[model samples]
Target: MESIINTKILVVMTILALSTGLGSCKIVQFIFGDSLSDVGNNKYLSKSLANANLPWYGIDFGNGMPNGRFTNGRTVADIIGDKMGLPRPPAFLDPSLTEDIILENGVNYASGGGGILNDTGNLFIQKFSLDKQIELFQGTQELIRSKIGAKAAEKFFNGSNYVVALGSNDFINNYLLPVYRDSWTYTDSSFVAYLMDTLGGQLKLLYNLGARQVTVFGLGPMGCIPLQRVLSTTGDCQEKTNNLALSFNRAGQKLVNDLSKSLKNSSIKFGDAYEVVAGVINDPAKFGFNNSDSPCCSFGQIRPALTCIPASTLCEDRSKYVFWDEYHPSDKANEMIANEIIRKLGFLYVNGTNTPPPAPAPTHAHAHAPSPGS
Candidate 1:
């Protein structure tokens, strides 16, 4: 495990070296996912209800103000970028974005409420779906070609890093919503299978588009999120939801491995978000946190205000809280999660020196779902 992690570090160190005048390799990041990964695209979705362009959100970022992130500070995506020495990819909808900027800094297509399936975030009404994100990426590919020519564009994209942080919203907003037919149309495992099949196709599309080094983040402990906990009378993590997430993550790790092998010259890594975040929630103090159940910024009596508005009550010290709101983590929690992700994945080379060999895939592909009572 350490060897693989070291290989990852080596890969990123190559980029860090380049960034510091040791080399001229251009390394930039492309980010995609739901709100947890969103930098500011949600702000551009004028009609979307699920947004974080409000008070207390991004309260610790660059200028200590909301910058379109859902949490009180940087999202996990932003923290990961910071850890890798790569500039945080600007939101794809940023009006000032240019083709040159993309070639230099890449772009973030992650928006609040985005999901793998096009229909997953329908209630949001104006969010990007994974397909839409890919479509925009394709458009970015064309935009760059117009500026730097096809060969140069291909080289840029091939060497750039791709970060895909999806799936959580697909379950949280769609499959679990009775308003959506998916909840009724498929059983838990079958739904996960459907998501995996779609994600497999999506990864293939990215490979075809010239992504060689990619890291796909798995869903964290969805059942343990504040929103899920509030659903239980005892305020415990929902076992069924947690089981569903475990099943999906198991499949996701397998998919990442299969794609790494099947796609020539590609190295895809799965970020084990579930275990790492679960560890934090299970024992917050072990990770410098004191509270993992209640959200730091909230307004409702039950906790998880859906959104943290100016009217919400704020925690005395966000650093002690695990969750920022109902759905996202506090900045401190994000940082911890980010560090763990980097430690585990080992490498991300938006533009680097060498590609490491694919790490061994996990042997287990499915977690046993608990029977009726147990």
Candidate 2:
């Protein structure tokens, strides 16, 4: 484990070395995954039970308005967009926007409760799986082609970065939930292997769809969160859940390494989110946080059994709390995590050292054709 951690640090250092000094490049972003990246995709789904389009969900947003993001404010995708000097990409499901406007900048296809596997978030009732998000992105490809022609669309997508952050729900909502728990049939290691394998194919699909720059966020310490703490009589971190999360994160690192090598003309960065959040959890004060184990928007009590709801008490100062609700991080915490990710992914080709070579110009064999008149 120490060796792997060291290797990950080395990889980050190498990327930092390569990405230093580059002034700017035209890098658009298309985010995928679950609630962690969902700007408002779940809000547009009629049957979606996993939605944050309610009070306190976006209390810290620009105007204190809930926009269906799971956090109290901007998500990691939104933060990255800010860092990249771009506005938060619109949700692909937003009916208020036109296809042309949605494709003007990349669109976010993330949905709360989404996972790498189709069956992972069945409890959500309606949520796009990673496969479905990719399919939606494929649809955007058609719109882009229609607007700018196929060749220009190819250049557009190749320059764009795809941010994917899912899989926590696969464990928290599926493997750990009583109704869908897989522990009876599969061990922790086996379950993580299943997730990694499924994700590998999904990543390949993005590559096929012209995504050459991608970032995958590793899972954090699930056992330390409030919801899991409430389940334990002792109210301490659940070691089993922590171990499972660590196992998945380690394997995810390996998956990123393998994909980086296999996919030519691509830049794949594994965001060490586990490390970042674990640091904040271990010493909340270090990150200017007062609470790490409890949710800030719980039902009046510090350790309330019920999580944030419409009537739940809100924190006086959300910035001091690491967690906003039971399962999601606060806006402040998301900002910290985003900063950590940007530190690693921020300068993605600073001096052209180890920079990914430009993707080959698109042809009929490159980007798949859109439907009739698409």
Candidate 3:
């Protein structure tokens, strides 16, 4: 009787081990960054700067309800969520949601007007610093672990992908803004190094906390933002701003490379977001974008502080424009950018084995879906 009982216990243990191993194959995508990657986490936090609660923000999303996204419709995070076989990530602040939401589809900790440094947006007291955002992400993970087991948590982290899109605000809000410029005393190189080191340290922290895959975006061409264009003397891109962005991208790439070498078990991927976005800005015609300098919204000769309300004149065709407002890109442009990053992810993570399958032929309902070539 004792021998038979021991045999049953061994069988149960073996089955449990196999089940755990199989469950690890499921992927969970954890996204972190600024407005570009932010879906609606900012809306959950008590802050007036949050756009997820405003109208016209989700005009193109069918629901016509704002969910904290900065665009007229879905942002890149939504597209990436769909591609990863998960439902759109809910705002971390949605009062109705529970830990199950994150355990199933992951969570977003990104916020608008955020930066790597603490003092990036002092005026917006509600905005989260990059470090704070990471801390939130870790807290979410801890919640998941408590709900599930450590093995399950490891599987979720190991199979998941992380997407980060930021750095624009550091230039526009922190460095260029008169308030920060007057308060902080750092040269261009010094500032760049400080920001990069902080960002790099955060990335390492995420990995140490159990992130297996990560994609860090470099800064886009800051000089071409509608806000910057309006602020420039000749209504042209500011060369100094563009140069600063280039330096940041260069440093970001090096940091990603170093992290990849230092980490033993995980693969950290760096997306050339700088080049991808800069190409669209520099040669809009090549990417089916018509206007790259100014946005499709109302133009201000000095500051672009004008509102782009629904009553305002929207471009006849938003798909042709790269930017939808002073700072955010249109859904069409976001789709293109997301497709580019997806292709890059397939190349880097899949060992070039399985390319993203050709996007299905579009029907009228899904006309905005990316093409196979994308």
Candidate 4:
């Protein structure tokens, strides 16, 4: 009788533990955005103006093979996917990927120099804009429906998390570009309003497509980048560019909050990238970084006038630097940002109450480890 009672007690404990401990259950992540989130889509596009599949780009990655990632190693997308128990999805443009694989695992449609508007990244003629990425996502939805039936596809869409980390290029590559100078036509506030309107509509379209959990990342401090700093006469961060980024982040935050309330079943959070990155930049030492202003792999006196090239000087300790090139963050910087963002994401997904678990956890099925009682 006692043996049977103990057996029953053990079973009950196991059930309780499993229910509470299986935290990172969601595995599929549908990522969309610009170069910050891009893995390798630009590699397949010959006409892409922002190519990174070259020396000094992936110098820190395994075997130093440039895998089309803009940074010296993994991007924030790759790190976040790791923490979420998700396998890094292949770029949609990867010719070797099959339809079956894409349906089973989500596809990454982010492109280098991509933006919210079709004309935003026009300098990169081959870049896929937000509208184009969404259209491709719709195609992905249909493919899933055709293969697994409508009900199954709907379930998958609802279960998966949608991530959008775009809009930076809309300002940097379009509004600020001398050739385009879209900002010249309107005040900063007006430009921000226009971007918000378009972005809100695109987000609504995504909700209509069945994304119950969506995370939208706001713009970082673009003015602090080496490229922007080099352009300033005083060699300091341009106040105008900084203001534009701030305006965009503020608008994005409000948009995400409004969408979360209106969508009813959806949970959307605006990743305050400006705040997170600003903190790191203000005190690089706190984040184990020695230099925040200079590029780790670019030429010139901290403020390089060109992109990282094959002959560019490389930093001995990549972790000591914050920026990898004139435009992007170092792999270590990305790792720090990814860790902080994942914690924020964990809190968002867990009903906004608890602190998130630590990083470097196992991936995929291993994340769903058995409970102690079991």
Candidate 5:
């Protein structure tokens, strides 16, 4: 009971902090999505290809040990949290994560290989799809309600921020794979429409769960990733795949704007990761990257390792390479992407309101931080 009071106190204090301009108060995040945003959720899955528990995965994380993040260091989500003075959300499946921790520091449910469609990652054997993620969040919502009653729980949940970075697997792992039924089920345009329809319902579910401030990241250049490039005979980006991503981003951007208005008091912003990361990929030197096509970690002669094995070739300077593996970016590239997205979204601020002074008013997400518990 005492622990519950402390939990409630923490929630109230955070709400008061945001409402009263207490800069020191911790901003918690409820994170979702896939490997890009996954901290360590996949590691907990028993039989999963969504694993990133091996060495060198988190070399730059804390003390040079893998912390379950797919990248070499922080993800785009991690860097964005740092910029906003928000705490790093622990993996939802972390044994150490309790109800107290959930309400306080928040939790990340993002899983590698997970996608909008449930069957998207069937090859992985185990993964939490977006629908599964929402179901898990409902459990978290229940825990919060138990701790501080329904009203206070609503206040806390509504005040907290949310981040969702997903949908990549729906293309590469699902629609593109001949083994999957979705490939033959829908054409390119129809597939994206199916994805958007699923994603739209997912976002609506989140809003129903008190997700007032959400950032839905747009897909980047899929054709330029090390995995996709290796498949190209000319060793160049596949423009056709890129155009498909643009189709999704176009419809996705519309969804963000539409949801922003429909979900009363909600601020659903679309992070323009497509343009930001493409800038780095197109002109690598401009962003301090020399080799954007090749991955920092390799499996020797193989274009893209399913996941880096123990015997994979490691690059001398991970920072110089744009990609860490076939699918994900290196720590340096993630930082570049995160910083640019932050600039566009504009959550960081010096004053109590936490608004970006230099950035243009974000046309997508809410420009001003919504009042806590408003």
Candidate 6:
């Protein structure tokens, strides 16, 4: 009777351990990028032009609060988190939150106006450079280890998903602007190559810091932005700008592919957001987008100097528009882009290992949940 009782206790302990290990397998998502992925980091910067603290920003979020997200609703990162069965990562600057927030899913280090280069621009002077974001990601990983354990943390990151969306500001706001265009004396090709080198170094840095799976988004068509259109002749997309974006995308693709080969055991996937976005612009109706060239907000004879605001005439239906403003995509557009990213991630995440279980359905209600797009 004593031996049997001891065996039962051992069985209970084993079951507890197994349950703990299984629960620890929660997948963490680390997002790094610019305005496209920024949740609320821009709000931390006082007097920063990158601020998104306004109503129009989160009109579809139901909260009716901006949250410093530069969109009519959730961005691609939010969709990725939803698809991964994790909550949208809280901003690193949210003082109300604790490390537990990060351990549950992950942390978002993305900030609007952030770029690969430290000396990028003036909009958000205090924004985290790509290198700094990666460091924060490392810190988050350490926190996860403390909360869970080293082995669990390792497993979490080993099978984790990393999404990086950036590079538009580097070209549109920094390199191409007259202030630096003459000062830097860099042609489009040289600028792209420089960006590629720096970004590749950053990817390698993340890899060394335990990022085994990474998805890098290439540059989108910046020429078609309302800001660019207003600045160009004929009020159309500047061919030169589009060419630069394409060049950057091509180079970025090569960089990600080469990095995968160099890293050997690591899996790095490149999402062709450039091509996908360009497709929507080139063929809008096919993707359920109505206006692809012009922004849905602040339309008409407004000059590039004007900003999209409440006073501006917003489109009646944001879902039909690809771009919400000058530099950001609408929620509908972001959902499409996010879906494409997930498809690519599926290939990378399930490449050599057993497929991860499908993410459970979301518990909380989202105002503008992601819908299927081409």
Task: Between candidates 5 and 6, name the one with more favorable lDDT.
Answer: 5
The 10-residue segment with the lowest total lDDT in model 5: 360-369
User: Per-residue CA lDDT of candidate 6, range 229-300, in tens?
Assistant: 878878888889899889988888899889999996888887776678888888999988778977776636
Error of 6 at 153 (Å): 2.9
**Model 1 TM-score on a 0 to 1 scale:** 0.86
lDDT of 4 by residue, 153-204 (tens): 7877887878898888988899887688675886788889988999999999
> Could you tell me which 10 consecutive residues in candidate 1 have the lowest summed lDDT?
360-369
Per lDDT, the best of the predicted structures is 1
Q: Estimate each model's TM-score.
A: 0.86, 0.83, 0.83, 0.84, 0.87, 0.84
**Residue pairs in candidate 3 whose N, alpha carbon or C atoms collide under 3 angstroms:** 52-68
Ranking of predictions according to lDDT: 1, 5, 2, 4, 6, 3
lDDT per residue, candidate 5, 56-80, as tens digits? 5776666555678887778888888
Candidate 5 Cα misplacement greater than 4 A, ranges:
1-26, 349-374
Which regions of candidate 1 are displaced past 4 Å? Answer: 1-24, 300-303, 348-374
What count of clashes does model 3 give? 1
> For every candidate structure, what is the RMSD over all alpha carbons to the true structure, in angstroms?
12.0, 15.0, 5.8, 9.3, 9.5, 5.5
Residue pairs in steric clash, candidate 2? 19-349, 19-350, 20-350, 22-350
lDDT of 2 at 217: 90
Lowest lDDT sum, 10 consecutive residues, model 2, at 360-369
Q: Please estimate how well model 1 matches the true structure, expressed as its whole-model Cα lDDT.
A: 0.83
Residue 196, model 3: lDDT of 83
Model 2 C-alpha lDDT versus the unseen true structure: 0.77
TM-score of predicted model 5?
Answer: 0.87
Task: For residues 89-197, write the lDDT of model 3, one tens digit per residue.
Answer: 5656667657766755667778877888877866666777788878888888788788767877777777777877778788888888768862368787888898888
